[model samples]
Target: IRVTVTAIPIPMACSPAFEGKSIRKEEMYAEFGGGRSPAFELLRVRPEAEVEDGKVTVIGPEIETIPEGSAAPLGIVIEVAGKTMKKEYEPVLERRIHNFVNYGEGSWHVAQRDLIWVRLSKEAVKNGVRVEHIGKLLASKFRIDFPDLLDAVQVTLITDPEQVLTAKKEAEAIYDERDARIKGMKDDDADTFYSCTLCQTFAPDHVCVITPERPGLCGAISWLDGKIAYEISPAGANQPVQKGGLISAENGEFEGVNRFVRKASHGAIERCQLYNFMEYPMTACGCFEVIALVLPEVNGIMVVNREYKGETPSGMSFSTLAGTIGGGVQTPGFAGISKSYILSDRFLQAEGGIDRLVWMPSVLKEELASRLKERLKAQGKGDLFEKIADERNAETIEALTEFLAGVDHPALTMDSIL
Candidate 1:
């Protein structure tokens, strides 16, 4: 749905025009998340009796109380009640939080789920903006955008350190639950893949190709979510792409996908590989939760998430590299991805799959540790998990090489990444 600027009781203007706007460090008043402190955002479908329309509550510190230019903890919990809203619809709606929050001209938001990092400009606080206003904006927009599906929307913004930490765990558990819904389904299981253009406003020529194993780059829409979204609104941005004929089974190129991506990108992109990360892989929009790139110096690859602010062994920060590869362009040797996509059986298949991975953030490694172990064990590569390096192990390519050699990581002996 198109974002419309409406009369909301917030000091800053809200519109799609600000969705891509950046608030540099000098312009900030307060910042949250981005690994600064615990932070999360969650949306849930609640019973009709549990939600109160237009209710917005700030559980802790208000704008006036937060110290200037300091990092803070935050948790946004939204509860919605509607006859048509189902548990399956939560993720798609939850993702709208990123877009709507970015709508505020003085506020900048990046990433999603618990990895969200937000900034508020001093200019906005001077105009009387407060934390509660954010909740008001969300409650107002959710109703305005999904009038047919939502009868009531209530938002609770938690800034209290204790509550933020508590709510974050609740949100993470739900996120894990949502991610498991499409497990065991493979790309070969379906003849028809799905495409979503919901991010066209951010990247005009982008088309999100969603298969059973790979989700949208935003990490929000799954293959089942795509089918459900299409069923809900046939005329909506999500549509099905028939996998007409196989172009390259190993590289995950399909004749019908090529045709659809060509038309969807308005001829900007002709071919998209569902699994290849080193050559003409899927195009990237702005909101990918993670990014994977080839580390030619080491003949391996490194994965970086949005929450990681430090430089990787490849000599670039996540944000810096994202700027180079994003905007719906197909960048060979690099690909944007969702965190869950790392566990997929098809991840980087063209580059020798998981064996090519060498470095990631320590936090990300811990987050994926449990499930990653299971996947590695299934592949009889459980020993490979300990071979991977994080920032804690090495922050530079030279250091990474030494670390890899010491650990005897498999990527050191893999085929040439190029």
Candidate 2:
């Protein structure tokens, strides 16, 4: 139940008890990212010459100088050096920043990669927890959590508006490179899948089933990344799960996967359907990314990404849904997923694939347009693209049904959802 029980020199206590805690807008001293400003974090393997153990560098004004309750840009770059460190481990280690930051009694972090949203509490600021303390906290935990793989870990925190903007672009390139390393792979094409239990720091029984089509719900570790992580540290969180007999091809249940889930969840969970959201869906750790839930009013489903601050047809904001869905529990009618999973051929396979997709935020809709267009064309449902709605079209259950009917949306005519 304890994560990094070692002493960390910070104003507030550091423990797993605070891992998924939230800080409200009124309770926040300062906020960053979350669509308000550019923010990103990256971890890189560096030569010993480039790393200074325990160094925490804060660029721009410290957190104390920032105006209360204002959002700011942020960029965190961690340079690590060790005899065993490899580039393949960058994402695996970088994601720990989310865990370490949330460990702060007064700090809250969500999502991962460029879509991060972080908040420092008024109480923490009053207790002298500054921006530099965040770097110190991360530096200590990185070494503590991966002692065998990291010898030295130094951190750089950039908060200047323009600098953060520039640094985010640089970090994005690195993300693209990592994503490219495992392109054009398929789940069934291989004999085995991968697992990620790193988030077990907070959601102990949750195990991320990483396949080529479905990345971790946090949107950080892909199937290829999981494989590389296991190779780097065979005893680590990522492990290979051989694809045994198919229990249900429609719902994406494998004999080997069910066995692994039972063992990993300590017998707490016995069934997990990877491709179905309304029946035994995988447990959600609720770190970041997107959430899909059925809106039975119109016989369809809607997806809301972390950046979407407004309420969805499901009558909940992204944060509210995250709180309700996580804690290693399987909610049959909902699932936490990466943005890329929406484009996968297996998305909601048992409930009728992407055809059940009725609404999403416009920004996300546009973000996946080209690739989604190709997917729709391949599925012979290219016209369904225009039929899909967004917030501008409808934000409530009644409005969504009206809009779907007005547009003759396929979901309205499809099979029952519930």
Candidate 3:
């Protein structure tokens, strides 16, 4: 199909896409192509380009120059290989979900037109493209071209399309199948599991263990995924460590994960672990603020925030040096992070008891939130007890770091703290 598209920059356009007559960020979609090889071309436009009746009256920003920043707007022009058609269209919600499944998370944020784009044509609409089919097409046609996006791009064929009625149902089925085997496992209550240790580079001395019942503070990965990742690599993504036997006198004691923390931190952090969020404790989640550390020549301790783009206080990039401090192991790279695992025992701990918990993101946490809340309240601290909550992001990570830095409450560490 022969098509031309563009992205338009708009100051008052309000809506990000055609679907959002009001909100600029919303997107609208349509289908094209099913016939022989179709010719296609892409063009970019500015946000102010008039799209009133569907005919391109004015041009917007240049396709290549379309700024990646949030303030800029873009327009995509699609011309069929044979016909001229333009109309405001609403995309099914499933389309976005499929995007996530095939692309993992935040596919659009990092995606460029070269990765995927619309190929409008008369036959495309006639075929009535389904998200599953699109995902497969991406996987078969474009997945390899973007190797960095394969896992994130959850491309899968819908063997039985009829069963998919809603996005929620689709998500449920996918997760159910993935989590079926990990329904029951246990971690020592004192172990304090978490997946937010990845944030150590960004928010030092803060660890957020993701449990089967609770997601990470960043709301990124679910415990089930974490568990699977753990199974894939035991010593790599995260390592299980003892917490109870720690010899704590004030804040400078604790064994197991604590010793691991000191080594991981290169002796930068003095004493602390998941359970004791007090001074120089477990590192923050990957999505956190203020990375704390004990740098050579630096007096006392040094803290780095999300914006401290300069050399890290640890003499390592926050991204690379983070794994070394969080889960009792030192990881040199960030690519293996998504592959980290979660174990049943991490959440179903029975010894010492758990005080605080942390994790990434997952629906399983939502389903089991109430039960975890009850468990926390039963251990006293009912006044401090709220509910088993989940959070994920770069900003809230600072809060998590702060919490672990001072809170001495008995914590339950997870199997995959990193």
Candidate 4:
């Protein structure tokens, strides 16, 4: 017997607030990922001959078959082929899937890369929407958004438990390889960086110049992402910023960046030091993954991510701290950065590097454990991770200072950050 659910027309314009809106457990018809089961989204550049234009395949159960209030494993693999398509563009396109999927009238999507959570509304199912509709939505949206760079697009949706697990593993490997390739790339290695004005809709003066070492504050766009974005739409938000001259190698100040920031911010920001938080740090647009604040009492910096709702050593919650630093203001001693940048060799090089990090939320520390360990080993401070304190160890400034003293944290012996 054929079953038909009602279908609602996709919205032409999606509200920005809808992107962050979450679906509670009680409200969702079906949930995916969110640490419940294996799930991932992968995008790949394929040879022209290997792709069938506009084809979307569903390997397992369709949306209507999923039990209400059930959590299911999900794997989304998108393949695109075009003369101009490059491997560097895969992640950029993959990231767009989140936004495109959210454009659906009754669907909600959050997060990106391997950590994704999605919910299909019962209203959508009642409208006769199926899993294949998501594939079509993505394929159509990509063509509309990147017409010049994509000649064909195909999407594969997997829900079978065994298949989801296998695809997730493969996606993880691909993700690691892509990350390694991007990590090997350095800012100075390129003659041009890219500017992202995507957040300008919310903060008009904010302009983010993304580099290999410094990804966007939102933790979404990388250097390669910016590059492809410029290639596809030269006049778009992502524009190429020629690296004209170097002002300070130690602090990562550049003549081109200074000029770009002044023009982009309409003269509100006169100067910016890319790798330093103590000087004229880059202005934040409010979507930053983490905020690094100077903790003068401990002579170090405490990192707080958006997910941390508790009080920080700075005696401020993440929201309160973000308000003080964000909105296109050149707030000295406060820098907004991507989580991956925390692992880079260029992470706050002028501000004493990782040695200056004193405290972070336990979840943030655990998330970066492997990377932090590797970076520490490279710096010949493999034991420093142990020396750093988390929320569990210190919640107040005094408590953090005492904890650092007890641990003999190197920041205590370093030059005063104040």
- Over 1-418, each residue of candidate 1 has an lDDT whose tens digit, in order, gives 4656678988889998878778888999999887887888899999999999999999989988999988899998999999999999898788789889988988878778888888899999899888888899999999988899999999999999999998898888888888888999989989999999977767888888999999998888899989888877788878999998999988999999999999999999989888886667888887899999988988998999988898888889988999998888888988888999999998988889899989989989998999999999999999999999999889999999999999999998887887
Q: What are the lDDT scores of the predictions, listed in order?
A: 0.89, 0.88, 0.31, 0.81
lDDT (Cα, tens digit) per residue for candidate 4, span 1-418: 2223223233322334444444566667898875566677889999998888778899888877888888888898899999988888887778778767766656676556666777887766777777777787778778878888999998899989899988888887787776677778888889898888876644668888889998888777888889887786778888888778899998988999989988988888888888887888988877687899888888898898876779988989987997798776778889888888899888879988889889989999998999899889988999999988998999999899899999899899998777
Better of 3 and 4 by TM-score: 4
By TM-score, the best candidate is 1
Error of 1 at 207 (Å): 2.3
For model 2, what is the error of residue 228's alpha carbon versus the real structure, in angstroms, after optimal superposition? 2.3
The collision pairs in model 2 are none
Q: How accurate is candidate 3 locally (lDDT)?
A: 0.31
**On residues 33-99, what C-alpha lDDT tens digit does candidate 2 reach at each position?**
9889889999999999999999999889898689898888888899999997888889988888988
TM-score of 4: 0.79
lDDT by residue (75-193, candidate 3, tens digit) is 22222111111111101111122232222111122111111222222232234432233333333322233233222222222212122123224444443443444344433333544
Better of 2 and 3 by TM-score: 2
